[model samples]
Target: MRMRAAILFEQGRPRPYAASRPLQVEEVALEGPGRGEVLIEVAAAGLCHSDLSAIEGIRPRPLPVVIGHEGAGIVRECGQGVTDLRPGDHVVTVFVSSCGTCRYCVRGRPNICPSGFAARAAGTLLSGARRIRRLNGEAVNHGSGLSLFAQYAVVARRAMVRIDPDVPLEDAAIFGCAVMTGAGAVLNTARLEAGEAIAIVGLGGVGMNALFAALAAGAERIVAVDANAEKLGLARQWGATDTFLATEPDCAGKVRAATDGGLDTVIETAGTIRAMELAHAITARGGRTVSAGLPASDAAFSYLHAQLVSDEKSILGSYMGSCVPERDIPRFLGLYRRGRLPVERLKSGFLGLDAINEGFDRLAEGGVLRQILRPNA
Candidate 1:
């Protein structure tokens, strides 16, 4: 089957992506699902900063690939030996598709499944196969197991989680990446106690979700920090106990002072060394600093070893919110349904596939949060 999809042929294109057009909309050949795989008619996909990093060459991926990782859709068909899901089931497309028998999966940490890691790096599905190809028969690499930028996708069964049909697909789209990474950082990685105070550095989709998760978990104080005053304003409206501009003079000192020396936990989601530094600086002694950001592969953040040891502080990295999709996606979605997680507020708007490059321009400009891409629109 030939389908319209976004293909990234090169990385590090000039900014104002509308002009440079890093993701080219092309008609490509898509094969039917193989055994243990599923075919999906994509309903909604979200533009993520991770994708932006790929476009900017911040994190290079396999070339000549159809790139899209965060999405939700309806199942069109299921391959052999697949039993849990069938045609017409609504599901969320997760980037990390774990092999159930992998050591990490057996340990209940599928988020770091080595098989998934190798597959993503090699641009194949969990089965080590590429389901898409250029019209001329050249193979097109899959993006994180789900090339969902197209109208349809063939993915590993582990790449999808059956979802409640009542929830809007556009809203569900954010769940795949932003909600999991952000909220999971707070709830799963940090494990903030109800009375513990926490600060979220960077108010992008992930940071904001950390803030929301803190609130829902009954944190004593939730501090929101961002360079964008508008995002800070949104944080305030959404129930941040305090809002601080990252650019303010002595911002870290102020946050530390205001929270009575420091917060119990600080989550960094900006994917920058500076944000990591700030998050670490504001964490209370004996508290933990969790980094959920995906900075350029070569980028690094440093801290004083002596201070860390003396303070008894710890730093942790969270990938995909340290989530086990089968368990966490539904848990988070339940929170959303109960209105405890108001993820709907994070939806900035929608876009058609042709407007995706412009959408990336807006994302790079920090003008939007999570823009849902409606491929069929």
Candidate 2:
């Protein structure tokens, strides 16, 4: 079978970059899954900021790569030894794959799986091969192990997370990335205990997810801060107990005031130097701040040495919610099923694969939550 994809031929252009635009939709041959692999006929895929980052150079990668990563679909084929899944099962594709025996994987962190640094960023499978290619006879890079922008994604069986067949593919797709990263930061990494006060800065995809996760985890007070008032309102629906519009100078003071001096946990997902600084200062003594945002090259954070030494404040950088997909993915799906995660709030709109460019526009518009690309539907 031949599939369609949006390939990044080059980089360093403009916001959304040439990578997001001029999407090349062509029929690409569907490669058969090898051993321990599964072939997925993609139904829905989400356009994440990370996808935009790679294309716009906020997050750099090799050229000629296919962009979308968060995808959900049905199992079209399964390779040998894959007993857990078969054709016709619905699943979401997780980009990070673990060797399972590595130190990180054994310790329960597949987000930083040992083999990922090389395999994922190189746009190839763990076995050093690319599964997606052009029908005209050219190779396409599979960013983050799954080239989900294509109509069909060929991925490892480990990357496929089986979900309830009835869950909407669009909702299931966003869970693969944004939901896990945000929710995991709170549930897995922070382990936010009940009655604790929490603040989530930057209320973007990941930040919003953090708020919802905090609510589900039973935090006493959840404060959401953002420069955009529109998103701050969305934060409330996602379970933010308080909303603070971050504008002008000294917004940190407002955050401190709202939290009654300092918060138990501060989650930074805005990816700005200012956001990082605010998060650091607003955290209470003995409190911890978890950063899930991917800051740009020019971003920097400054703090007084005594603040760390005397106050006992700690800062943590989280990747993929410190998650092991095999475990966390299913747990996240469970949250969605029970209505604790509010996965539906994360999505803004849906578009067809040919309308992929419009999805990026919605992302750039600032108020949009998440835009999905529906290929099969």
Maximum-TM-score candidate: 1
Error of 1 at 122 (Å): 0.4
Stretches > 4 Å off in candidate 1:
none
TM per prediction: 0.99, 0.94
The alpha-carbon lDDT assigned to residue 201 of candidate 2 equals 88
The TM-score measured for candidate 2 stands at 0.94
lDDT of 2 by residue, 117-169 (tens): 68877878776777776777778877888888877888887776898888988
What C-alpha lDDT do the candidate models reach, one value each? 0.91, 0.81
Error of 1 at 265 (Å): 0.5
Q: Looking at model 2, which ten-residue stretch has the lowest summed lDDT? A: 13-22
Give lDDT tens digits, candidate 1, residues 248-348: 99999999889888887999999999888899999999999999998999997888899999999999999999898989999999999999889889899
**Which residue pairs in candidate 2 have backbone atoms (N, alpha carbon, C) closer than 3 angstroms, thus clashing?**
3-28
